[model samples]
Target: MIEVKGLSKRFGDIRAVRDVSFSVEKGEIFGFLGPNGVGKTTSIQMMCGLLTPDSGTIMIDGKELNPDSTEVRRKIGFVPQETALYPDLSATENLRFWGGLYGLKGDALNSRVEDVLRLVELTNRADDKIATYSGGMQKRVNLAAGVLHNPSLVFMDEPTAGVDPQGRFAILNIVRELAASGKAIIYTTHYMDEAQKLCDRIAIMDLGEILGMGSFEELRDQVGKGFQIFAKGDFDGPKLAHQLRKEYEGEVLHSGRGLLAVVVADATELGRFVAAMKAQGVNADDLKIKETDLETVFLKLTGRELRD
Candidate 1:
């Protein structure tokens, strides 16, 4: 339903997005995964016609996305990170207002508003003022407002940020329902678990460039076998680091006075690693092992952690 090629944008000397490209099918959830300030939102803005690209092309349903493409824009629904509803307005009022902006009216508009409210599981609180709702509830209504017109493709930019776990769970289900109904979804977030849970394919981006793109497992393979061992103690970092590089088929990811992290191919060698630490006479107050995750992938690709 959507295809982007060589998409790029710049703010003066800074390249906010560079040579980015990807595609999303009618029933697929395409994810833009990265940390903040990596241009995920800027790329989305260019695609949804909120911002013009400095270079490259954005095609939705075969036609180009430009200022004159009102019809193409109509096929998309964008739910931004922040709530766009009026504080004094109830959910029904908020959705009706947004629906009217889409030129929806009469029984058709009313039916759609009700349908989306039910879809987000907010029908019971449909009449509550947005100000009276929790962050999660407001988010659900924000989602309802975005798709009230039944757009063919939806752009959800961190729809679950700052929401409680239950709220996040509900929003995820709503997204699944949207995809099950055959609407293409472009979901952008830094949350690994959410992307892993929802997206069929993910594009990992950093410094305005796409470092990797594939399913979760596929991206994991790109980094080879990775299991991180983090130890915090007084130890000879360079000494142990040297030993790791020479003896193990992995990299000493982080090594310093108080912390040492190593990514090993096989986790079964955990005992020997612990033994080696003891042989070095290190006393670790905190030590932990992490299996390969999106954070690990992000670190391997960008040389920075996800929260960084």
Candidate 2:
């Protein structure tokens, strides 16, 4: 339901978004995976018509998103990373205020407010001031305010950041429900597991360009049979890391925490490495044998850790 072509944005010498192009079909959850300064938010801003792109086009349901066009605003709901709500206003009151922006009034607006509040599981606190809510609760209210207009597309930026596991689960479930009901959702987050669970497809970005785009399995296959192994202990990191490189004939990465993280050629090599570690008197706890996840792909493409 959303199409972007050659989307580019620049600020002086720095190109924040560079020729990024992707499409989201109806009922799809497309993950815009990237680090903090990877232009995910900038791309979303252009797509939502919040900022005019230096070039390219954003088409939604076959209609272009014109910043001056009220029609585009009617069809999109944006829930940003920050909670954009009036602290003194009650949850219900906040929804009413936003819903009115989309021309929703009287019973229609009230019903949507109630429905979204219940969906976000903030019904009991609907009448309570937002200032009294926890971080997670405030996030739920923020989300409710976005969808009160029942827009066909929603842009959610870091929706689960800083929330507890229960709150995260609740928000993810609500996202799933929205996608199942045929709403195209553009979800942005640094959490690999969350993207894996929620996105039908993903676009990994860095330095104003799209490094890769595909399903998890597809991206993993790009790195071939290489798998990562992590073992935490008071081991000789550099020595063990060298041993891994020589033994498996693949790259080995060591962290400052005396943790050995290696990329081996195959799963068989992973098993052998574990056995060798045990034989060498290394405590095998914190052992993680994982195929290339989005995080690994991010690192491989960007030449840096996701946190960096």
Candidate 3:
């Protein structure tokens, strides 16, 4: 229900986002992932009409969207990383206030408040002040406020950030239910496992660009369908890395710290790699094939491990 093309934004001398383009379909959860200061927030702000882009186009259900697309903004929901909630107010009170901002009023606002409190399983303590609630409970109330308008597309930035395990689980289930009901979602988080568990497709961004985008398998294949053998301790890491890079079909890198990684495509290639290492008089106390995961894919794409 949303499409963004060639989107870019700049601040003085720094360009926060550059030529970003992605789409979220109905009933799909699109994971917007990146390390800090990599344009994830800037991009989201433009899409939500909080910031205008310098170039490119944002389309909401086929119509062009802009900062003043008042009607279009009605179809969008934003769940910020920090809660815009009043601690003095109860959950029901907070929802009532925010729902009114979305043009919800009277019976419609009251009914939505009741429905969402139930949907997030917060009806039991809906009357308690938000300050008395746990962090998880507060987050649930924050979520309730965001979806009260029933927007067709939602942008959730680190919704599970800092929440306890139980709270995170509850929020994830709620996200699934929203998607199941045909709402498109743009979810951002530093947690790889959360992205793996919830997102239908993933986008990895770095340095204001999308380094990779696809399903887990598709992105993993970019690093080659392989095993990354990691070794530490005494060894000629740079020499071994150089030889492997020159002769092997996959990637090889020496971290300049005691670590060396060798990526081999399959069993036969792995065997040959092992033999080659032995032939080169390389011996290390630590050596084994590590499981290739989303981090591995990120490492291949960015030449560095993911760090928050």
Candidate 1 stretches with Cα past 4 Å from truth are 232-239, 246-260, 281-285
RMSD in Å for candidate 1, one decimal?
2.1
After superposition of all CA atoms, the RMSD between model 3 and the true structure is: 3.0
Worst 10 residues of 3 by lDDT: 247-256
Clashing pairs in 2: none
Compared with the true structure, what per-residue lDDT tens digits does model 1 show for residues 224-274? 666888777777666767765544545777666666777876777677678
lDDT of 2 at 124: 91
Q: lDDT (0-100) at residue 31 of candidate 3?
A: 92
TM-scores of all candidate predictions against the true structure: 0.93, 0.87, 0.88
User: Candidate 1 has what TM-score?
Assistant: 0.93
For all candidates, the clash counts are 0, 0, 0
CA shift of 174, model 1, Å: 0.6
What local lDDT does model 2 show for residue 203?
91
Local distance difference test scores for all models: 0.87, 0.85, 0.84
RMSD of each: 2.1, 3.4, 3.0
- List the candidates ranked by lDDT, beginning with the highest: 1, 2, 3
Candidate 1 total steric clashes: 0
lDDT of 2: 0.85
- Residue range 1-308, candidate 2, lDDT tens digits: 89999999999999999999999987899998888988999999888888899999899989888968788779999999999999999999899999998999999998999899989998998999999999989998888887889889999998888999988998999999988989999999988889988899989988889999988878777665567876778877777766655445556643435677678766677778877777666775577778777777776666667872
